[model samples]
Target chain A: MRVLALESATRTGSLALVDYVGAPLGAPLNGVRQAAPLREITLDASLQHSEKLMPALIEMLGAEFKIETIDLFAVDHGPGSFTGLRVGMALMKGFAFASRASEASGKPLIGVSSLEALAMNGSGLVVPMIDAHRGQVYTAVYEVGAALRDRRKSLWDGRPKLIEPEQAIEPEKWLKYLVEKYGSVPRLEDNQIHARNVAFLAALEFGRGAAATRPGACHRHAPTLFSMTPRYLRAGV
Target chain B: MFILGIETSCDETAAAVLTDQPLRILSNVIASQNEVHEPYGGIVPELASRRHMEKILPVIQEALDKAQIKLSDLEGIAVTVMPGLVGSLLVGLQVAKGMAATLGIPFVGVSHLEGHLQAPLLEHPEVSYPFMALLVSGGHTLLYHVKEFAKYELIGGTRDDAAGEAFDKVAKILGLGYPGGPLIDKLAHQGNPKAIKFPKGKIKDHPFDFSFSGLKTAVANYVKKIEGGITPSLLADLCASFQETVVDDLIGKTVLAAKEKGIKTIIVSGGVACNSRLRAKLPEAFFPSPLLCTDNAAMIAAVGYHSLKKGKTSPWSLNAMANQDVRFC
Candidate 1:
């Protein structure tokens, strides 16, 4: 199965295509958790996600891959740039819905938290932080080590969970929460989220069957074409 | 040929379907967010974009459904991609691009200003080219000498606040709430336009240029100086006076531009073109329907249809420009 993942929760938005080995009929395939990405393209959009994303993704896929080959669509939803998330979600929804005209059923859409995706960039206890403007950061804490004792258990089968929910808060408070959770804080440089990391985490989610669930745990939600909306945490007054 | 147009440049999430050979509009649906932003007394950009994200998909689907066409029937897709809120523009543009790609059809990014330019053509297909166009809207106020399709020369424009924006601001000063254009227009009918005299702003030696910031300030000062502090009666006079000043400047400058360019035919478009005063004053000029006067996608698709015929299609790399001069294209 192939998953087309989009990450536009920040200025630097990107899309990736990851292929997963389907489970055998009798027994689960039980492949390694972090499968290598097949193709990944990162966009240094500088807040130009809507204009640069579609063209970049089409060029990245080229003519070799058909649109039907995409079994799942994923996006790094919310807690980042509000416009960025909307553009990414709209593109994902459009692709998912339009492709349904030809296939037996529409492809599944997977939305992952940008903060959590950032934490997946490295091993060990991770506290991902994104500059959310207004002198605050959109931060979340995650324990992304190989928590599962069995290697056959997928990493995204809900093993590594979010230690703290994502929220926009002051730097001092964010640091305090991180310190309280994990004895000491990790380096600030390690918490940076990348588009490639978004693809990698989405691949884990797809392999774990979390993509098929209606509403999974760990801030992951599968959205239909009509019900999809960006996770705008800072939405009202 | 069938085309789909999506417009989210501002508060209106609009979508339309147009067929070719005569450029007939099959469907035009708009989901306006006026009520959502009414409490603020003006459009809030962030709030506007948020509403666009929520309504864009359903709006497009409804447009297709109303046209009695399926997604596969569309030969092309057009979206307003410039000269408005970037966040709002992105929502429509990205979706159009994705749909076009999925359907294996071509999609083009139409300029918002160009969409205004072509709006008259939708209703007045018999109208020819080489005419002066007065585009007055919340975000823009300009005069253009359009020689032909894709040939636009900007002659005059507002120096400060756009004409419609000034109306909105002045209306707020009188407690008229958000979108002062229609309300002020209604009240101006009851009160005498000559009740209070307001200065018409014009630059020295620049006959076609306009400045409404001073006029807006003058209204603000007058309202503050009134002995009773702006009663309903006083508000009516103020709306009438302010509307008169704006309408005179707009008509006066546009007439001068037309005469100077030696063009007899004039076209008025955009949101402010729906004003009763302008409509009554410029009977000769072609004005789009009241529905088309505000932002809509039918005009965008109309312009896109012609643009695509001319072999002009924006690539997927087309970025949304917030402040692009219409003449440069």
Candidate 2:
């Protein structure tokens, strides 16, 4: 199965195209190795996503691969830039709509959490933080199991269990809470969420038939289009 | 040629499919966010954006389905890309870009104001150019001298509140519901338009320019000064009086501009063009049907059809602009 994933929750968004072997429902995780994207491009942060996203995708795909060639579409639904998330999702939804119209059956769409995609950068007691502005950050703490850790690759193998749910809080208060709970938190480095990680995570879900039957999956069983709203954790306007 | 038009400039998520040769609208779908925004008594930009994201695709699909055409059959796409809420505009603009890119078809990013200008052309194709256009909406109140397709010259505009905005603010003060234009128009018919003397908005040096902030403030002051609050009868009078002043200001300025420019034909459009009083007073002027008067994709598609025929297409890098003057090109 081929997955076209987009990460536009932040200013510096990225796109990746990955190929993975499909697995049946409730498949075991024995030989499903994480595959890297065949092509990936990081967009310029200075330009707006509306200006750079589609053009970049067109150039990246070129004549080699049309949009219809991709089996599944994945996007980083956000706790990042609200406009960026909507722009990215709208673009993917448009492509999915067109692809579905052309084919007999529709394409599957998956929405990956922006914070969770960032969590892939760390292992064992991972805290992924995204600047939520207004002197706050959108963050979540994850307990990455040792079995999922791979010494060779930068990204971890399996899903990181959510120890602390996502929330938008001040950096100082969040750190204070983490230190009190976990005691002696590891030194963390700020990292951008790459589309390759998004694609990899989505591939894992797609392999498990999550796109077909998962509770929050955009499309389940049928290949019809659904409204996949951005995850803006901040309530109200 | 079959063209698809998308508009999410503000609270309305609208889409339409049209054929350019005979200028026939196959399907025009508008998913209004009035219910979502009615609680706030005005449009909240963030909420508008959220609703737009949810309805954008479905609305477009419904338009295509009603048109009885496949997405692949569309020759081109047109989308409103400017002079609106940036977040709301981006939803439609990005979707258009993606669909066009996927289908390998050309698309144009039309201005919201330009779409309003092209609206009259859909209903009255014989209406010649070099006409004066009065575009009155919640977002804008302006007079333009339209020389030809894609050509517009700004003649007059509001100094503060737009005409539709004044109606909304006045309606809020009057304890009326949101989208004050239609509500006020309905009530105004039952009351005397001359019941209360509301001052017409005027700018000192700029004769054609309007200033409705003062009028809105005047209505607020009047409502507050009332001893027994407002009765239904009084409310109708207030609605009538307020509507009278706004319609007078709009018609007066448009007529002045038309006479000054020696332009006989006048085209009235945008949300406020749905006002009964405005339409009744401007009998000689060309006004599109109530559906076309408001924000809809049919107007955008009309503009797109003409633009594409002239070989004008937006680049892949076309971005949604929050504020831009009407493009003369």
Candidate 3:
């Protein structure tokens, strides 16, 4: 199976193409210890999501993989750059809708959260801070679970879970709130939504049969088209 | 050659398919969000963007179906990519890029203002070059000296609010509701234009520049001074007086610009061109039909047809611009 992931929730944007090796349908290896992607490609797009994203995807498809071989598409639906999110959503939606016939895995598009994708890199209490400017930051907290050792454990059901819902707040106030709640502020990192992590998470969900339902917007839970909108936190005036 | 045009610059999600040989509009479909924005009195940018996402795909399909063509039949795809609400503009731009790549056809980004300027050419093939264009819409009011396709020179523009915006403001002040142009035009016909003397608000030094804010304020103050608080007769009189002043100002400046440039032909377009008063008053000038007057993809397709002929095409990296100066391509 082949999965393509696009990450443009922040100033920096990226696209990842993964070649997955599937095990037998009923095999224990299919549970959590599935095959890793054979080939992964990520490009730095930084603030040029509109200009660089599509051409890069074209180049990747032409040079590396066939468009028809791709089974699913993923994008980091943002609480980040407003323009960046729109560009990413539009491009992915266009791809999903356009390729609906040739590549029919039912729902082909999945939106990975930038915060959750960033949190995938850290082990402890991970807080991903996306600079919202105006002294405000869009931050989310997650608690990393133990590594999956057997078929009994899954990432979403037993592993990483959101501790605090994402919100746009003052950086100082967010830190203070975190300190008051957790007794200490967790380490903050600007991972900038790596496409590799996004692809990893998306493939795990696909393996767990999340793609059986309708594709969620830019998040993991909801399965509606309206959810694909950019989570700017504040509405346009 | 067949070209598909998509426009989602503001509240309207429009698409059109046209043939290049004779420049015929096979299909021009527009899904307007007037009712959605009616409650807000004016457009809410976020709401408009949300609506565009939902309507864009279906609207394009309808345009293609109405044109009796398939996606594979299109020679190229053209879209308005600039001088619009950024969020709304992105939907159309991204969709067009996707179509161009999938269909293996050329893609070009047309300016929203340029789309309006080229509208008359779609309906009236006889109207040729070197004509002055008076483009008036809710967001803009400008006089352009068009030497030819991709060669536009802006001679005059609004100093304050645009002419269509002035109508909308006056309508709100009079409780006429959203999209005040057509309603005010209808009411103005029942009343006398000479009933109230509103200021023309023309620029003093700049011979053809316009300023409608002061005129709008004058109407507001007049309404405030009325003893009975805007009766039917008073409303009609105000609408008539205001419409007359706006129409007179638009015509005077357009004619002045034409005379200054020694050009006889004038092409009036944009949303305000649909106004009955403007059309009735300026019968000599060329005007697109009512549907073409408002924001639609047909005009963008017209500009696209011309752009393609000139061998001008945009790369995949073309980004949306919120404000593009009105000039040649």
Candidate 4:
């Protein structure tokens, strides 16, 4: 089973594949996690993509990794880059749905939060923040308890707000939100989250059955790609 | 099944086949109309579009045969629809749609620019997203932060004529004929790039935006002053001077963009991307594979693979997008 994952919501994005030795990924075969091997490329604005993604997949399948057997696909729904979100999600949904249809009716597909995954493997309180423009950021807070098997994913009850430097709450808001929402308390003071940390959380959640129960997690079928929208925290501010 | 991709965005009429289980390209055929347009200095879209319709079907047939596949074996169809000449784009889109409809399969409309960006990996197979790309074509000049596969940010773009357009215009002014880049490039090697004190429009602080109009006009005015007594050596000098300015502007903005964003990889593409000067002067810090240039359906088809891998399929309404219709300038 070949499990290919795509995360394209940040400046330094990542792609991973979980290779299981079988007809498809997750079908009771030996498996191992591998980063989808990416060749270094010079990127420019007008260098249109229509050819970018599929070739790499083809290369993988042809030489070493076979794709017809990709049993599970993991995609990162973003709190990072907006265009990446639309492009990546559109592609992810398409692939997942295709895989799900071809599956033997028992397999499930899913969407993973890029930020959450980036925060998962962290050593301390994971405060994942993605630049949200206009001096704002898309951020989430998470804190672990000792190590894996005892970790937690924090939630917020209120609407995700865009706070400026002046309106920003003290770092304690992470703990405050956790306490108010999940009623769990954090033990850390200042801990910054990185991408790998987010990826780790995503992996853990998928492993522990904490995420999407179906492929093409999006409930909507039609996604527009030609529009460029500015994702901001403050609405009509 | 065989998937034939037809692309005639500018000077190139390209056809490629996506075949078999892994969707590997069997035959990638591109018949560049650069020479035909070179005498005109710049591609006249009307002529280009007309030529595309004339040669498109043959190119398709050639690709199908080269791939050792037949139309009967083709399951679906794909064509580049947008961000290019409406006239040129229609030729490919119409052909693909016609073929698909006739064959009773789904038609996938691809963005032409996406085709260029996705070209290199057809053979190399290692290129992926989270990189930067500079698409420099006769009709377009822009910078994109390829934040992910098939996802692009319009970080910077040409405010006026694209790099290739400027090359053609400058080449014509110097009496070097049309499709000016190769001519200018060859002439540049014969003359000194520093011969003319041409200006490189430094939109200092614009970050990624570029403007080559001023330089193009400067070279034209220089030629006008010569009053038709254009010397061969002088033309070479002028071509070198103009080419130098264009290359500087392109490389400067691209390198600066990569540096500012801390992006490590940068790929320069498009017909103008095939320019020798740009191929030489583009700062090596960003682009390591300097030859990963040129406009081909191979890239578009490769990009198609990434889009599919990322799961980016289009509905029937997704038409070929024009440059004006694209998200960013």
> lDDT of each structure?
0.81, 0.85, 0.80, 0.57
Q: Which ten residues in a row have the lowest lDDT in candidate 3 chain B?
A: B96-105
lDDT of 2 by residue, B179-203 (tens): 7888899998888999999898778
Which residue segments of model 3 deviate by more than 4 Å?
A23-46, A55-69, A100-107, A133-136, A148-151, A154-159, A169-190, A206-227, A232-237, B204-206, B259-262
Best by TM-score: 2
On lDDT, the stronger of 2 and 3 is 2
Give per-residue CA lDDT, model 3, range B48-148, as digits (tens): 88778778777887898899987767888899998999878988888788667655678999998999999998889999899999999999999999998
Question: Which consecutive 10 residues in model 2 chain B have the weakest lDDT in total?
Answer: B320-329
Which candidate achieves the best lDDT against the true structure?
2
Better of 1 and 3 by TM-score: 1
Clashes of each: 0, 0, 0, 64
| Per-residue alpha-carbon lDDT of candidate 4 for residues B193-296, written as tens digits (9 for 90 to 100) | 88999887756677688888998888878877886697888877887888888888788888878788898777877777667778767545233233335555
Clash count, predicted structure 2: 0
What lDDT does model 4 reach? 0.57
TM-score of each: 0.91, 0.92, 0.87, 0.53
Highest-scoring model, DockQ: 2
Off by over 4 Å in 4: A1-237, B19-24, B32-50, B102-104, B226-228, B283-294, B317-321
Candidate 2 per-residue lDDT over residues A1-237, each given as its tens digit: 778899998879899987776643234333556676788999875538888887788788886667777777888888898888999999988887777567744566677789988887776788988889999999998766575555425454477778899999999998999899889666457577889778767666655555346533442432335477888998646
- Give the lDDT ranking, best first: 2, 1, 3, 4
lDDT of 1 at B205: 86
Taking the candidates in order, what DockQ does each have? 0.54, 0.69, 0.35, 0.01
What pairs collide in candidate 3? none
- What is the TM-score (0 to 1) of candidate 2? 0.92
lDDT of 4 by residue, A1-237 (tens): 445565555554444555433323222111223233232222221222223433433343445543445545555655555444433443444343223223433223455555455544443455555555655556666543344323322332111122211122334554466577756643323222232233333333344342233432322331221111213223221
